[model samples]
Target: MTGNTDVVVIGGGYAGVMAANRLTQRDDVTVTLINPRPTFVERIRLQQLVGGSDDAVVDYPDVLGEAVRLVVDSVIGIDAAGRSVTLATGATVGYDYLIYAVGSGSADPGVPGAAEFAYPIASLEEAQRLRPVVDAAPTTALVTVVGAGPTGIETAAELAEKGRTVTLVCGEVLGPYLHLKGRRSVAKRLAKLGVTVLEGPDAQVTAVTRDAVQLSGGRELRSTVTIWTAGFGVPDLAARSGLSTDALGRLLTDETLTSVDDMRITAAGDSAAPSDLPFRMSCQAATRIGAHAADTVLARIAVEQPRPINLGFFGQCISLGRRAGIFQFASKDDTANRFYLGGRPGAKLKEFVCKHTLKHLADEARKPGSLTWVKDDERRESLRAKRGEAPATAERAA
Candidate 1:
């Protein structure tokens, strides 16, 4: 629809990078990516970083496209009416279209003293800070990990394997996303690693302190180091910018990934909530949503009818230190099934998935739009039904 279309993609995570690289498929599009860091962070391996295993970083040159411009800056405010973004560096960048992909950070622990005492390993910077704290602690010091999600399980295992006395305090059930069989497999692995698994109502953490964690039923455990991996919260940039957002601050978008408030704005990754149904925050959904966001923008520029997003789920992979893991298979809708892979083979598969995620971004950078994912027909149908739209023929990306 124009001579040169300028698209500004905020956030340099998997979603933003994929969207930026895919936008380069068209000659008329000029993509600019803005992020707080120059290097890409491997969020999936942040636990490994905290455990002193991996660095959890990738150079932008290896993942960002040559045609895409990289701006190492943080976006403070977005002027939707003026079509510009005010950066923290006091510079403003104008764009014909904006792709919101700021991703997420650690959620606030509602419990008392949690924020002040517990270390969060959600972001790369947080992981880097926690690594030193973990190393300085005595080998026999009591380390307590709060949460039973993949991050907590992995972090607890990683630390315990390093010869630290680790305890996993699952506020709720361990691996709530996993089926009973998968959950058992994980428990077995954690037991093998000498990690104390605390579950049931008594396992709920009521408060965190300087040297101990208070749990339910008047239980208190000595914790020299406490790591919080409970929940994730997105940036408030969208809501602060006067854009429509969900309760969690994720930008609200239609099924097509276009912002419901403004046609010129779209969202992807953990920062996007489409049709009030947001995908689980993971690298698997981030890449697909990022690619779909780019396609939506490209279609609008070409004056073609943009296709709605079609995404599918594979499984959930969790690493139990460097030697063991669990791969819980999921249905297309992302619910954990009974099938799972445990032990060494599971660890290898988890490692492969982490490496493959980076390789995908690199491949998309070298060849725009080279990445593709499986489609969930049921999800598309449900979304269309919710919108009162008639069923349409399926279309797959090449």
Candidate 2:
């Protein structure tokens, strides 16, 4: 099976980039990364893009291995049976192994009028489209940020910091993953920034309109711009290509990150669902899984046994603004703890985390096999045991 092997990585986000770069550990493996854009998007800084603090992109040469081929195009379909992928440009690339890391984007709002009226800043294009509208709006216009996730909070705070009026409508809770204390800290900062923090069950947005937003409590708030960050939706490429996927359309994979139905295909990043329990969408999880995906492919090439995912989280970081933020600590299982660092220190930490994401990719690109991460020991195993289920496994040695 081997003179030279071509590996096609379909996505250029954290996971895909990490996988492509790490795949360079073997001189005989050719890595080609396909993405819709040429530059590596720093998704974590997208909110900053809207705020005009950052553009949220890095040149591939800065973060990708020089040996990896960069294909600037979108993948339209995958032929697992034939070991190839078709791009939007009507070109097909055959691969000995495929890494499905097509990351997620904004979810269908489902709320009445949301799809047509609300702006989503999840991806680069979306953020670029939103920035101008926000800037063009009158300074007095009320900006409504829907959803209380990290993106929502960050966008609201960023806008508010820029002297734009912001209203954060939290359908359920503000920073649901944050400890109550951390949530309070964020609330305090938002209040200081003159942002209206609306939470609780009745805080749900029932509809978005050209000039206003309606809440579940029958209260309507006048708004000039509406931003949606409630949830994410992954690309339907897997399902469209006839691969088994989770309800959300992420490729169903085992703990080894290999496709459940095909050993030659593996998935990582936000588009990957391992054990049918996908990790929360974040750059942290994506990079870790990306490295593992490359490891899985390399292990197969070496005919060595690949290890299951042993990923763990340090915590969540949320930027309140350029000078204020929150770093919520979490347990190994990714549950939020009450302990958190807030204020200027938290801001510094958040900034560092964002920069470090790129640094990790650069480090991997510079030294293909140099990246290392903390591993979770027993939480997932204990959870699987309680569910009375066996971890998903895959065949090795492609």
Candidate 3:
């Protein structure tokens, strides 16, 4: 609506960068992205970062639009009413609209000694911190990777391939999101890597120590390094700022990604809880949501109706070192199918996905709205059905 329109994006992850780049479509819109780090973090490759195979940091100019002003500062608080964000450096930056894309970090383990002993590989700093510690440990040292998520599996494989003795303690099942067929493929690869895969309820970790990790079954294993890769948790910025959020502190928003409490604020990435049901916390969902978030703001500026988010996940891909991987195919809704590409082919595909993700930001940075993703009308309706709402009901709510 105005050349002076100011949009500040908090977080420079995939979602924030995507939003910031797409916002450049409107020359009148001034976009400023505030992040704690100067380089872009490739979160999907954090395991590789820990393994020292990749650095996981990209220059801001590589992914961010040239028009975007990069503010290397953390947002301590958001004054929604005043339309300003307080930075950690004791400075306040005003904004006409704000996008919350802080993404996520490893959730609290809630087990004894976990916080003190286990290292999480969620953030770039965490991975950097773990890399040195992992390198210092003897090759014979027992490396226990807790949780069965993609992060845990990838980390376990990454370390094991480096000649480190590794053990993967799955709380219940390895790759719980993967279909049985896909799970078997991953298990076979881990086995080939000499990674001890522990499953079942008894495999659930109940405690951790500097030298050992205790399971729920009363089994204690000697572990020199414990890597925690459990659930993900969002920043408390939304809650602390007195904004409406879900129980996990993700900013609650409607289908249009607009905060329920303030129309001027929107959320994207792992930090967003749309209709109290967040999509899986991954770059797959983050980039799409980020583009939609920017589109929502653009729609508002144009005085047009903003459309609801339409997202469809393709499937899951877990790299078993750099040599092999398991890429499970699925419906648009994300449930794994019986078919999948395993071994070297899957590894190549997984590598392509990671590279293309960065290319997406760069492409959008140059072309603004050049990015596109798959979507299904049936999938959208099913999501609303789960919320026990009709199409008209969701429309009015939005």
Candidate 4:
């Protein structure tokens, strides 16, 4: 903790930026964040952006603290043993510790021609690419959204509200995460908006084309636009780094968020799979994970005991349109853990949550290391050092 301790975060999303901000609070840590884009694209708001909202994105300078250095580059590989990251630009970053929060992307189900024919709104770039097609098409154009997750539901509802013919196709019932009451309410909203909902007992997407989608039921749904919002798949960076990953390529980490191979490396968000927790790919988990990662790094640097993360999702939110939504309550400490809230009231709550999350992160960026929510003692009592590990000091760049 004497010399310049470099902490390189391999992503710039919510978790990555928050980690960088938190680490920079200590005088000895020099935080470096690497991301492919220059601006902070709000992944949660991509559906809103596609539905014609420009208020979702924040300028990088506006979100990252002055002490946190930003590197607009792609990460090609990681050298865990040497504690270095290789960039697509051929530059290598040496770090005393690394935080992996590269996040996940849309999964292309091996359905025939799906990847080649369907459009995905997972990222800002993808949304930008789809905007023109949406605008050029006629008002009555048929737009099909695959996957009835939050993203799909939001996109379909938003489009239908915009006076377009929107059809939502899901392998399961609409908003499978919602409670029965919430699901029924959302279905009513879809019906009111004239949006078509197709459940996949027999209509699973088998093929996608520029002009149509072929379902397993042998029905060809004519679509001028096809938006995919299915599940997510982790990036290859974890596996490429030679770290242990789950079957889905998510890096497996101890409760302390440390990678299985190297305790000095931590991971969070959709890309990280904690040994104690099941699959949860939501912003609620990402925020807490980011804070926990920062605490782990800070504790290790200070030679203090690290803490364990116990954050949970209260419930889930699915936007039916710009003005309607359903908020399901759960026991997740961070989100609402109650029944469902819907209609204008639920939409207002959902909007508040989205805005508030960004605002909190933004405020944290301005004042790094101020969050006490992620207690240090939690890490120390939960994360015990593994035996037989050598003190890693290799300096060769990746």
lDDT on C-alpha atoms for all candidate structures: 0.94, 0.93, 0.93, 0.82
Candidates arranged by TM-score, highest first: 3, 2, 1, 4
The segments of candidate 3 whose C-alpha lies over 4 angstroms from its true place after superposition are 389-398
lDDT for each residue of candidate 2 in 57-154, tens digit (9 for 90 to 100): 89999999999999999999999999999989999999999999999998898999999999998899999999999989999999999989999999
Residue 119 lDDT, candidate 1, scale 0-100 = 97
The lDDT, on a scale of 0 to 1, for candidate 4 is 0.82
Q: Residues 1-398, candidate 3, lDDT per residue (tens digit)?
A: 65679999999999999999999998889999999998999999999999989999999999999999999999999999999999999999999999999999989989999999999989999999999999998888999999889999999998889998999999889998898989999999999999999999799888899999999899999999999998889999999999999999999999899999999899999999988878888898999999999999999989899899888889988898989998899888877899899999999999999999999999999999998999856656776687877786568888
Cα lDDT for residue 89, model 3? 98
What count of clashes does model 3 give? Answer: 0
Between candidates 3 and 4, name the one with more favorable TM-score. 3
Which candidate would rank higher by TM-score, 1 or 3?
3
Q: Where does candidate 3 have its weakest 10-residue lDDT segment?
A: 376-385
lDDT of 4 by residue, 1-398 (tens): 56778899989988888888888778888899999998998888888777786536789887788988899999999998788999999999999999999988877678777788788887778888888888898998899999988899899998888899998998768877776777888899999999999995865888998899998889999998888888788798989878889888988988778888898899988888877343378776677688789889999988887866766456887777888988887654332333788999989988888887777677778887665443333322223323333333322231
lDDT of model 3 at residue 75?
98
TM-score of each: 0.96, 0.96, 0.97, 0.90
Q: Number of clashing residue pairs in every model? A: 0, 0, 0, 13
